[model samples]
Target: MSRILVVDDERNVLTSFQHLLGKKGHEVLTAKSGEQALSLLGSNSPDLILMDIRMAGLSGLETFRQAKAIVPKVPVIMMTAYGTTDTAIEAMKLGAFEYTLKPFDIPKLTALIERALAMGQLMRTPVTYGAADADARAQRIIGKSSKMIEVYKLIGQVAPSNVTVLIRGESGTGKELVARAIYHHSQRAERPFIAVNCAAIPETLLESELFGYEKGAFTGAVARKPGKFEQASGGTILLDEVGDMSPSTQAKVLRVLQEGTCERLGGHETIRVDVRLLAATNQDLEALIRDRRFREDLYYRLHVVTITVPSLRERKEDIPLLAEYFLKRYSRELQKSGMRLSPEALERLSAYEWPGNVRELENCIKQAMVLGQGDVLMPEHLRLGQSSAVQLRSAPESLNAVRELARQHLEQAPGSAHQHLIEQVEAQLILEALMQTQGNLAQAAKLLGITRPTLREKISKYRIQRRVHLNQREG
Candidate 1:
């Protein structure tokens, strides 16, 4: 459960929030004024702070600054019965999670509170490579394989430095966990660690989401908002699936790397950002660059240091260990005791190739925990279904593999060496993605790290000999 601190000068506001948030399973601590909130911070580092902007004494802005100094990672959401656009913008620039006019819409307020709590938890949660600590809350990497050990070592070596890191791995290979581990062990451990799923966010809003926006920036943009970079200043920001970013977003991100500044959409003023940027991707960036999809400069900037996580198939020896860890974790979470994986179940888990990697294993275990009865979880409980296991796509080719192919292509046609390399690699990558997705254009596009139109254009540009139906949307 999350602990929330609600601060307001009015007694009714404090009591209402305390009672309402309490009903939602959050431990709500309320204070009458900014001074009281600051005092509360002395002893408690709440996951989220909800404060009124117009508090008596201290003031909400001052309290927010002080609260950040006290617990730098905690997220604060400011509310005011008397809110102006300037006040909201100021609060956001000061690193408030959100700013809202008071007389709260209960549902919207509750949703906002949940989001802040989730963001705060993501920032502060510990990521370990070994067994769970005494407190079961720590997320463990759950492998002793040499591959994983190397990954752990890389995380350690790179965590202390301020270099931008590129984590390469298949989807669900625990890249986010690696990013979190780096953050937790780094010098900026006390500061926030914001994780943005670049692939999940739509291309249109990705820029505004990263650099925020000015009021009247768009039709619906009623007020100015500060972006995650601002909120994570002096901290770290992990851009998950950074490969899927659009060219415009990529250019903006490159600017942030070259110069520590970004301008919000429809705004003239440049905002300086101080963040340790970490990017993770499953895409073959070399191929993306070849296809002219991913920016070459941005790729170079991100790949200053690279950590490649082993896919589950590559580290099959860790299957039993990971399965057991998940069993215990889900047992505790689901409140089911004496739940053990059967010998047959262990054999089954070990035999099957995990296409989705660690995340799929965790989900499989959690599902089994809910399905299996008595003490032992049987093989049948696993239901290691045919669909995922049957579609055994090859791992993404390494940059070295691409370079080797480039050498062969250059030897063949020195006059158009680069073009030959791009054609061969892009065509091959597109074919593989199409075959993997059974010729579904959308999925192929996603797998190829480009848009559907771009993918269609490449299909024609390469004049791929293998014809596939383009109309099918689902793969």
Candidate 2:
């Protein structure tokens, strides 16, 4: 049975429809005003909304408009006792699924509701609904950080034009997110946004992937195929990891950018594609150009609108919000209730250096959510420091302080070296993990997913032996 929400100011009409729909085996909810309906919507999304045309406070038409704003795809059937041509026309114009005059045929209304439900199910999936806020409809950027705000501004400024965008960032820093943000917010938002990773594909296949190929283009070419450019005509194409692309492919890409035209491999016909190109690279493209690995002309072409995504370390302030967001997101999926991070745990997270950036932070949070025993997440829930057998020994004011401590101890020690750089970092990580695990090394190693010996090597390397001896002597 489909879920339906009925909104009307009349108690009698609401009772009659609720009884009728309930007996027909459909689950029904009732709301007297738009505010109540909105509250209901926040909890659960109904398949269809059956609204009376006139109501008190907020009119049915205004309610319907608000409903569309919240959940654009839900089908709404407007009902009115006093039917007029203008009302019907206005309802249709505003995308109402159907219009019914009050005291009307109940059977016809039921059929229309069923049809609207079926149509809604076929048109869009709920997962795709409200994927982001309404403001993000034009851009897929999911951030409120100052860095991302600047990225959003750049998107708005360059979206209307056919400017090539070069997005630079560290690996897993969400370069593609920025690229998608640009594509979805641009004039080509309605069109397909195709992304091709330059490094993943083989050199030979990269050309054929960007430009179409004739049936006889190469020995393996059995049928004609369209390239990324052709498929993205009048749309946007993202060349991800562009710095890793082969020099030969770089030359081909340069031609497409300069001429807006390409010839299929082994095909004489020249095809033109009006595609806006967006390129992304973690590597410095200028350095690649200087090394003769990337074409300078191509670099200039793709750098028309540059957007640089800051590493997670640069925006540590966003960690708490991002952690909460992911906590809620994964908690809902896992059906776990009352999940939240402790302030201490969040502080520990914010102090660390996220080498892997957002991707690493997301993974850490996901792991923590799975390990958390109660509503609140503690430092032990995260296995970050344990990954490399490194145990951070101090709660420093900054990442730089931690690094400085590690360097000072390494450089100033006059005895047999206490630890190598890697060993110290690893020992620090392991110590933090052990503290979180309540001194359970086996579980800590398991959390780190390493054999006890490897963990032991890190412990011995860090010269924690003297500390253990001192504890034994004191005991």
Candidate 3:
């Protein structure tokens, strides 16, 4: 029997957890807030903590941070609702064992708890990834941000199994890199790794491309062509941008997933292939399912263990590391030794919302390296597109833009729009200033055209924690 701590702001949820776990013959402790959870930790060391992501005061993420400091070895499992999945992912990056959506399945929850408890013991042991073999497997993947660390952990946990994985992120977020990472770490590393971009291939040929073709199947079909599925037999096949696949193709893919067999376009023989399928897409598949653009059955077939890659903006703390990595990479490729990014360049890079994600950042660094004259890349050398330029505008222009945005939001929204819009704008401006100044309150205030005291008060009012360190002077 294990002692579990259940924390949530909802009294009913606390009661339900107590009743459920009590019947399992486990000792359960309950807390209503983060403070209460921390207080409980002083006297009782539970084997696991199950907590809600959103609470009244201290958020589950903040609470998880504190709890880890208090009891580092104890595993924490966060419970989140629909829209708060990203926050729960962030919590996972901060050392939470795992997260489950609210109204979770009882069987899944029980299985997760059992696994967490068993994994807790393994986590306590000192594990190092310094071996040359392990380093070689993960060399392409960079970023030490908590979020990326979480991704790394998940990859390590899931790569060995032949599980269907759905990698979701915006374009340029390096979903393919992640897919490759899993392939490299898996037992099938020696096998061929084939990648097919579903969107890039026309729907007319996608079926043939994936499932192969028999001789004389169509015009210009002179010979038998083994499709990607056949080519990747005993290996991994990554279906990139899979959401764009046609319904017929989706059905075929679903058939392949379900039956593990596919027939060539004109052949009657069913080809049995042992291939691991990995699907990636930037689109909201659930929304697509609602609109009937995507097949819900196929979505379920591929979403066995979903991994949502964090956008670059969401993990801004990793900007410097990524920038430096790109710098060295491009420098060596271009044969320009001793290339580096300046502090101002890094600060701008960090402050910019990378809509194109990591892919855009890499291109910007490469462009700067190509055009930049000196060894050190400066702010002027970087071109982050029109969006970034707008983001870097003078305070007055930014304020005016925010005012217009708030006006539009108010016009469209109902109920307390004015107050909400004002608070939103205020918080955004303060957060941007802090990000640009790398959490230097005085510099941020100066940039925002506000007094330090006023900025401090605003930070407190908004409960903003300056965490990005992009503006640190480059060494």
> How do all models score by TM-score?
0.78, 0.55, 0.54
TM-score of 3: 0.54
Judge candidate 1 at residue 29 and give its lDDT: 90
What's the best-to-worst order under lDDT? 1, 3, 2
lDDT per model, in order? 0.82, 0.72, 0.78
Candidates 1 and 3, the one with greater lDDT: 1
Worst 10 residues of 2 by lDDT: 466-475
Off by over 4 Å in 1: 103-106, 130-136, 386-475
Clashes of 1: 0
Error of 3 at 112 (Å): 47
lDDT of 1 by residue, 441-472 (tens): 76566444455656776788877635655546
TM-score of 2: 0.55
Writing each residue's lDDT as its tens digit, candidate 3 over 1-475 gives 6799999999999999898877665789999999999999999998899999999998888999899788876878899887787787566545566678888889799888877776454333322221323332134566777778888888888889999999999888889878877877787765546678999988999999888677689996655556778756777789999999999889989988999998889989888888999999999999999999999999999999988889999889888978877777656445567999888888999898887788778767876765567799889888777323334343587778767887788788778787788788789878877775557665565446454555666777788864444332221
Better of 1 and 2 by lDDT: 1
- Model 3 segments more than 4 A misplaced: 1-139, 386-475
Residue 373, model 2: Cα distance from true site in angstroms: 1.7
How should the candidates be ordered by TM-score, best one leading? 1, 2, 3
